[model samples]
Target chain A: MTENSLQVSSIEFSYGRTRALNGVSLNVEAGRFVALVGANGAGKTTLFSIVTGLYAAHAGDVSIMGHNLRAETLKALGKMGVVFQRTTLDMDLTILQNLRYAAELHGLSRKDARERISEGMKLNSLSDLGKRKVAGLSGGQRRRVELCRALLHKPALLLLDEPTVGLDMSSRAGFVEHVRSLCKQYNTGVLWATHLMDEVNHDDDIYVMARGEIIAQGRVSDLLAAHSVDNVTDLYNLITEDNKNVVESGA
Target chain B: MSWLAALRCLRGVITREGLRFINQRGRFFSALVRPLVWLFIFAAGFRSVLGVSIIPPYETYVLYSEYITPGLLGMIMLFNGMQSSLSMVYDREMGSMRVLLTSPLPRWFLLFSKLLAGVVVAVIQVYVFLLVAWFWDIRPPVMGYILVVPALVLGGLMLGSLGLLLSSLVKQLENFAGVMNFVIFPMFFASSALYPLWRMLESSVVLWWICTLNPFTYVVELVRFALYGRIHWLALVVVVVCGVLFLGAAVIGYDPLRGFLARKDGGPRAG
Candidate 1:
């Protein structure tokens, strides 16, 4: 049986009075790339935090590789790799040291870690920068290092949270292409969370979130068709119009 | 997870902390200089003013520097513990801690490894201070140096565990100043580190009781005895119990469901 690499069901989370995630749910199956598109305050990060076990959900079930996150946290987390919204690399350490730390954290043997780091560095065209401190790397190089780190463990599921926020257009395009290639090459499941409209391709599966709920989900083309719109921006404006009104009125 | 996996994780954390300690020259110098100031300048001022009677660890009358060596070592561990907590909060803010927390290990094991790594670094600093005190003629028996390693580890564990717990309580770097003032200063001053229980009793009964109640007092006493090739059984038991409690509390404090990370509005603290 083919199991979803990630399955988040009816997850709810709150910060005292503010409900950040309200009955949110989604899934990413093996070998498929799924985009979780949302506005700035659409609860994408909150949901990701819960799924990654940063914060326990007030209510919900999250399973990874058919393993329940709460009951089998280590097994669930073992099958995944995550690139958080911010740069998590230690600026003080050299690129090689940072990656080695991640590799060791994932429990790869010395031989395996060395082989995989070499391959990942080569794959990201970061071979020459291994000895350089992460603080000296450009934004694009840092992001590449992060991607290499995330893939070092060969995770079955990869989660990226707004990874290309500050990159230039060409760098963003290159990063996206590289991630897509990695997904197809390894048959890895991907949940790419972003607020940018340009990142979602016409044929890719997408989930549109607003105000802590998934308002629409399907292939990009299908979502446009279902909403009787011709483009992503129009589709977003049409679906989130009510949410905007509610937020405006509440404010 | 398997034993090899855990060992790899432990090695990784320790290496990272060790590398950080090596790279931070200011930190290294300060860790040495802080205790040396007390040993050289402060102890010299107090040598004849406040003499130490024949303590168990010392067969005859010991000079002020000799009496305060174990206390200075304990102070090193205390400051090192507080530094670790400050960095934990800073790491939480910067998002590096997110990567560590999400690693595929038991949370308890990950936390314990972090504690052990920090204590190991502090132990090295303790030894360096011992080397400095050697020049000051505060030398103990040769075996005393070898045996003091275990005592330092035990004392470091207790202090480091407390640091881990404090990281969860004071979430912001700005608030850490208060922690140093409140936790470090009070613990350092009210403990047996600076003076003996007898001295405190001579000063005031209430002050003596406060020193006796302080867990850091037991840590100092434990290190003091171990450095002389002896064991203070009472101090040993107290340190062990306090270590377990602090580690347990720190484990819970970092817990996603039940601890400080459970339901916060602004999220984790900033550096």
Candidate 2:
């Protein structure tokens, strides 16, 4: 089996005449946190979609846990769990029902699902809220439930797309800490897509995207040293500025 | 996937649909109300103008209400079928469809499970309509009531499959309402649902040909024969075949390689 949890080779995708992804490549290894940082339209969601098998890339290969997505799609997909940027919970169903449905979708038996749901609730401190409908939950609470649903199947590679968009500062911190702990506890590889600089932890790997291309990627300390910057914020601004200058000069 | 896992997935989907159906009272009522309005108001007005000769299944003359009741049952399934598809479009826009598609099960099985869930809801609405029509003095024979179960299921599956096909083709929610109008109106009007095929032929040869070609006609006829405790084998064959074909097309339309819904380019990416 491969060491990396996910390996996306140089992949390109286009919509009609305009390109959505331009030869992007990235990887997430076991027990590591990889932050994909990009402004809007930086192709974060598109890349996530490609990895999750929602859209096939026009060019390139994506493998999850050593299984090729195209040839062994079921096996490849079975190795991962995803929480999309948008809320996917059924608003009409209770929180427990939503989690159970997700477990069943992953082909977990009833007994296994019950055990996992309970274990997940305890892990996230989400007990006692199980009976509430998702429609009634606050934005942050709903986001936590989504996270719980994703973990019920205990997937090796967890893909989360902007999972903390509407969360408050304290809630955001809590969510981040919770995910970090889970990654370490299970040795699960995580690909977290976000635009918020605060969510990227120290020592984490970073991929900076602009206009659908991955402009820079490396460990945070290495990226800072390479860019002659002291912090990720300054390094990010410098990289975007450099790209802007090159674009302006070329045009 | 193992057989047990596939069955579990199917059960999850079906149970969710069932819960939604029970929770939404307005949706349940609306599914029945449309057919009831046609059965009571429209059929009453048309009764004086339309006289029925004793057909093979009929020992004596039948009133317009009695004749159109089976058709109204088909109408219930037809509208509910489209409603399920409309929800599918909404689901795609809201990102739940992505969750559904990402499941490890085969794409065809996932889609077919969804279609079957819709059919199950439609079948329930159909039986409720028959019960109401029964109270209105339009009851079928006792044996006929038992026989119509399979007919209504087949009709529901057929209409729901068409809904799946339409949902895959209609790209946006704003565009789906117009497409539904185009599809549902023509299907109801051109079929033998509202009037007999002979009546359609008397109006125009072209109209008759269209009514004959419409798959909804077979669905209505299949239900009608079952209500009279008989079988229309040709109509049965046509309905089943069209159901399978539409479902097949739907599965293809959802394929990630070249599916209409799978076109991520040019469209704003939904989270």
For each candidate, give its TM-score against the true structure: 0.97, 0.97
Off by over 4 Å in 2: B264-271
Model 1: per-residue Cα lDDT over B33-152, one tens digit each: 999999999999999898988979889999988999999999999999888878888898888988999999988888888888889999999888888788989899999989988888
- Model 2 per-residue lDDT tens digits across residues A70-115: 9999999888989889899999989998888888888899999999
DockQ for each numbered candidate: 0.59, 0.63
| Pairs of residues clashing in candidate 1 | none
Q: C-alpha displacement of A158 in model 1, angstroms?
A: 0.5
Provide all candidates' interface root-mean-square deviations. 3.3, 1.8
Could you tell me the lDDT of residue B130 within candidate 2?
Answer: 83
> After TM-score superposition, what is the CA distance of residue B122 in candidate 2 from its true location, in Å?
1.1
Expressed as tens digits, the lDDT of each residue in A63-179 for candidate 1 is 999999999999999998998888999999999999999999999999999999999999999999999999999889999999999999899999999999889999999999899
Docking band of candidate 1: medium
Total backbone collisions, model 1: 0
